[model samples]
Target: MPETPPMTPPMTPPMTPPWTPFALFGALAVLAWGAAALDAALAGGRWPGIVTGPLRGAARELVRQRRRTVMPDVPLVRAGVCALPAAAVLAAVVLPLGERPVADLSVGVVWFNAMEVCVWWALWLTGWGVNSLHPLIGGYRFVAQGLAYELPHMFALITAALGAGSLRVSEIAAAQRGLWFAVWMPVAFAVYLVSAVAMAFWGPMDRPVGSDIAGGVRAELSGPDRLVFEAGRYLLLAVAAAAAVPLFLGGGVGPALPPWLWTALKTVAVLAVLVWARHRLPGVRMDRFTRVSWLVLIPVSLLQLLVVGVVVL
Candidate 1:
């Protein structure tokens, strides 16, 4: 009895509250809406358009009729349309809302990249399922775009992961306690940003959905179908912008604001730049870009990765 020690409570992993997914979804929705609003504002050259335009357009789509194509593959079309937003949301799970992520998976970077790859599948499905010439071409365009951008993008991501010696996005963010990876790995950061636009098919990289092809993959969709697809695209763009914060920028790092506020501000800044780029930059053809991406981008990214490795060592 004299030697008996007090019993200690068993060490247990903390249980995530059930509301976590809902909170993450709510945050994602807000960010996506902000992106849509910003794009609308930039296009219209008025601040008020930001608030009203997106809402008005969404309302119209919700009530509009969904036009059916001749002998359309309904199941595939539905799957692709649904998967787009799902992939975007899944990708956002790794992105920390403030100081913590919803999932906080050990391989957050890989998870983000994998979810992004789903866009290729989604595009192909939607385009092919429609059984239309323009959509098919648009799908082909995206496949080509992905082939060109993905290698350099992967290298850029690897450079960051290598620098921090961790694939976990939170750890990468934590590694930049003093100097941000963007400052030192500027090349990688630039590459990452370019790939971000390409991944979202936004701004100058929007050839897949170019007006020349009459809305491309989304040309045939209408009503609620169109609404969901457009919303998914905005969500993808927002998620890409959000992912940049942890990968290149210092996540939630800032001087005065709370971490979550810092994250939101940084994300908005990135989203604005992406939206503005659409107005400023001219679209490049996929063939020309493919040549440049392979020759210039791949080599440059590799060199950046080498430089980062040296610095890390």
Candidate 2:
């Protein structure tokens, strides 16, 4: 009788709820518009500018002509400009909306990093393809910047994954049910924020499109091409800001509000802080920033990672 015990059923993986692609893109569009409006308002020092500025600028760009450059690699420039937003969207796939991601990849943390690397490619191609000196310099600057920030950025990501002992973003978010990672892992959180800005080439990291270099990488862009590139930039920033929620801010874990609403609120808060930083922080030279990144940030992040590992053990 004991030997005839009924066989247990096979274990099935938990099912994830379905989410639509349109929802993902729609959220991104709204965030991008918000970022643009906020930046415009700050620049003008008038709160009223936030209402109509983004719409006015977008309409103008849509109808403007694509300004020609001498011996420009048109195809390459086109690819680069379009790829920026495409990369942003792809990266957002692994990021959970409320509690479910469009694609809940096992290695979501790694996936986000890989997609962000595409920004470097986009910048380089756009800079080089334009066949201009300042743009070329801007492209090279980003490469140097990448080398500087990417190491600490990766370590910060690894720390988050290590703390949860999972690469899946949702799992990581779940692990923080007790305490938000940003609260415990302050160093990693700070580094992540800094790298987020640098990756998007926003705020203090806008040397890639600095006014001194005549708009740098985007100097030659105009019309629809310019529109696409600018949209892509804002989109990248929005995605970066949103990813922080799952990574460090305890995604969708607030009280009272629905999970999705909590996610939206957190995202807006982060995006506002990032946009405000542009008006406050001074632009830094890539060389000096690189030195600080390697000498200071890298070591600090490594220490933070070590502390997290010990605590986990």
Please name the candidate that would achieve the greatest TM-score relative to the true structure. 2
Q: What C-alpha lDDT values do all the predictions have?
A: 0.87, 0.91
* TM-score, per-candidate, Cα-based: 0.93, 0.94
lDDT of 1 by residue, 102-215 (tens): 877778899999999899888888888988888888888998898889999899989989989998888898888798899999999999999878988888899888899998
Clashes of 2: 0
- The lDDT, on a scale of 0 to 1, for candidate 1 is 0.87
Tens digits of lDDT, candidate 2, 164-212: 9999998998888899999999999999999889999999999998988
Clashes of each: 0, 0
Residue 203, candidate 2: alpha-carbon lDDT: 90
Per lDDT, the best of the predicted structures is 2
